[model samples]
Target chain A: MFGVTILGNNSAIPAYDRHPTAQVVTLNEQLFLLDCGEATQMQLSRYKVRRSRINYILISHLHGDHYFGLIGLITSMGLLGREHPLHIYAPAPLQGILQAQLDVAAIVLPFPLHFHALQQEGVLVAEDKFSIECFAVYHRIECWGFIIRENRKPRKINKEQALAYNIPGYFYERLKNGDDYEPRNGETVKNEWVTIPNTPGRSYAYCADTIFNPEVAAKIKGVTMAYHEATYLDNLIERAANRFHSTSKQAATIARLAGIKQLLIGHFSSKYEALEPFLTEAQSIFPNTQLALEGVSYRIL
Target chain B: MFGVTILGNNSAIPAYDRHPTAQVVTLNEQLFLLDCGEATQMQLSRYKVRRSRINYILISHLHGDHYFGLIGLITSMGLLGREHPLHIYAPAPLQGILQAQLDVAAIVLPFPLHFHALQQEGVLVAEDKFSIECFAVYHRIECWGFIIRENRKPRKINKEQALAYNIPGYFYERLKNGDDYEPRNGETVKNEWVTIPNTPGRSYAYCADTIFNPEVAAKIKGVTMAYHEATYLDNLIERAANRFHSTSKQAATIARLAGIKQLLIGHFSSKYEALEPFLTEAQSIFPNTQLALEGVSYRIL
Candidate 1:
């Protein structure tokens, strides 16, 4: 089950019940929070997202709309008696800011918190099945974008053939790894006789708050799913450029340039109450575009 | 129209749709925000409280549930192009915290901010119609409580008598101040003939997070309306004492001991879903007690 859940999708100001930017990426058994904005914890609760299951938090920037809800969420985690280790990947100054908040309240967390400063664009998390990488994006201040890719090669086992060969059910994982089964009767069952190659793993990219830059498109090329910020429509191209944001047309252009399968656009400006125009603009450029609505999950297929 | 609107009333963790502690005090033409918790800005929006009208903010403690929304609210104000000055009265360390947040984002607020540290906690604001004072409260950490008093003595003018005296409408303010009005016709209208003394001004006290202490009741005696934190019910008195929090019965006792006309009990524990027991426990001791429901305005009369 690989998908991205939209918790909040608004920009700097919250309007029309649209909250700031926050997204949860589910890759198999792991959950990674992309960006935590103000009231994100409330959104998480409203959507019935399990806060305890989240182990990784990646902050894209230091904007108040991006990381203001971080303190409340983390403190609530401690109050809920979370004992597992939590990891945070963000800019250098975030460490001091979090420390100051903890110092002021004199809070001693029950869980081990690992802070990874984002200096260079590289791998952030490397697990057995998936890996998350961070890359620089063009914003007014220092910012970053993240991509999570499933990096495993597994084979699909033929159940009929395995059962006919009298193979045990518990050896399916080894069969998927292309291992031959040796039964108690000393009969050798070849791996290729019952196994075939499976489909390749998928990936999802979170293009956190960036301008219209082809370099960003080049970095996340050929991703299965991509989320880009379309803060304004095409008519407000100058305004989007001046604010270091992207328009709907620009976001769709990047998605098309990167050859992504599915494109999700969000971070709508508070000035916009009707979002159909944003959809029209993006879909005109890229047909596989969808509006990132809160509480809705888009499958990474 | 002097009253308090409860924005949030939950304790450390938000549950059952109740948020953290934050209140908006409407004193005539001025608005004062008390203890901005996480998502307080969203609450202000939900309650239709004009964020632009809030000129003063008072933070009681350094708890994350108390002040996590400060940065988001102020930054949104800046983004909305607020030009009026905003005053923040909090602990000394808060100044550095705000500075660090602003430095990371490189945000230059459009309005000038005044930070008044609550060192001794005496007179926070002294205006013509009202005066707000801060006092120490017994909490786990250094906390403070606040009381707002209407200071001016106003006189009620007799409309019939003023019409007979041929007094213009502009002379009403002077008449309220016990000043005799002289018409252009050279007839002196004595203040005693047309005006009568009105009732004394009302007062509201906000006893922030604290334990059961008689000293706090002594500080806010004779207040018209008082809001005390009731973090637990009577059954959890030992837990309340351990956490330096007050139970429902204790909050009512403080109100009764202080001779308050009305009592509001809130800051409910997240463990409880139903809040009717809180009102029942408090009203059992003090009949005028009411539960502080979010978005409900409790008049200071």
Candidate 2:
């Protein structure tokens, strides 16, 4: 269940049935919001993603299209009687903006809001299940990217081998946690006897709102899946560079250089009504590129 | 043509097929946005309303469902390269919130932003074609309703009578302005001889997020069309009162007592999946009642 669902894929202005930047990274039952833009909550409702399960929000920058929907989503969560504390990780200035909006509306949340200002390139959240880290990106303003690494799963049990060893079905849950089996006859079985090691944990990196920078490839090197902003086509390479955005070719180049297993490209400019050209252009450079479409989820593993 | 286009028609939470409150008051080529909520810009785009033509935005309250989309719309307008100045009318606290967001985002609008805080019950805007007035409403927070009154039109020209008078075709425009005609022979023609009095101008009042207050009828007396919040049906009268909201029956009663030609009831509570009951209940009280459907325009002729 380690996947990312696209809520909106358009760039600054939402057009042509495309919305601004917003995504939901799903890990089992937990959901983490990435860059909540306008209509993010509506998208969540439309896509049937449980808003109550979204306890953490990661905002890349202070752009209005990136985080304008945060206030409304937070307020709606309060109205929905959410008592679970919410955590928001963004640039430092977001706290003042959120506070002013809450105070103006006289909204006293039913839950506490924890704000974590992203300052340097380091881990923002480290839990037993996963960890999220931030890295710098070359944008017009100060911005950062995020990488989420899910913790490695425990060994898988061989049901036939476990049955032969007289292990009850109830003990399977503990066995998956790398616990050794103990029979009533005082015979202790090693964990390796009936279990096989799990594959490596998956990692996904989100390179938000960046220009064509080679450093990005080095920062997100060797990720299982990578999402890059391809705001323009190759024809608008100069425009993309001037606006601190990346072209489809540029995004693909970075993904190919980083050796990512898959590249999800989005944040498309509203000018391009047809999206086929983006896929065609990126695929010509990197065969593993995929278009980030609304309501579509790309599994990291 | 003067009309009111419904953008959203639900209460605090957007659910089912209904959205939060938002409307566009159309006056010929210009538009006046009223209470922009979440997904309002999307609604505007969906309904094919020219967002660039919207020069004025009126927020009735500080509720997130009423004004959360304002900042997004403004930012989008800037991104779309709007050069015309935009006017916004809301409570005083909204300025601080908007400013903090803009400061953090470092967004300098290409167009000027004119902010008018709604402090008193008086005329907020008075133009040659129309005038807008604000009045207090009974809500949980400080709120106001708006009245858009079209200016008195000139006399309608009688074509046959003008032809008999031998008036030139070029003089018809002036004749509609109530101008007298004179021939080269120096014989003055009276305006009444070739013109008839124009019909009375139309007035529409928006009673935003209010309780079942009988006093509201007096404030919006004699309006051509009136829109009032019907957040609940007759069965939830007690709940409506507790939440400082009006039921469908209450809304219709206010419209009937105000001598309105037609009543438009909206701001439906999201708890109800079906909306036909609201219209049925309101029409039973006021025969000229209509349910405000999104994307539908109610012409005031």
Winner by lDDT: 1
After superposition, candidate 2 runs with Cα above 4 Å error: A155-198, B155-197
Q: Give lDDT tens digits, candidate 1, residues A1-301.
A: 9999999999999999999999999887899999999988988999999999999999999998899999899999999999999999999999999999999999999999999999999898898898989999999999999999998578999888988888899999999988999887887999999998888879999998999999999999999999999999998999999999999999999999999999999999999999999999999999999999999999999
What C-alpha lDDT values do all the predictions have?
A: 0.94, 0.92
The all-Cα superposition gives candidate 2 an RMSD in Å to the true structure of 5.0
lDDT of 2 by residue, A30-137 (tens): 899999998898899999999999988999999988998898899989888999999999999999888877887778899989999999998999898999999999
lDDT (Cα, tens digit) per residue for candidate 2, span B158-240: 88999998999999888888889988897899999999998878988999999999889999999999999999999999999
> How big is the positional error of residue A241 in model 1, measured in Å on the Cα after superposition?
0.8
With candidate 2 superimposed using the best TM-score fit, by how many Å does residue A290's alpha carbon deviate from the native?
A: 0.7
Highest-scoring model, DockQ: 1
- Poorest stretch of ten by lDDT in candidate 1 chain A: A151-160
Of the true interface contacts, each candidate retains a share of: 0.90, 0.75
> Where does candidate 1 clash, by residue pair?
none
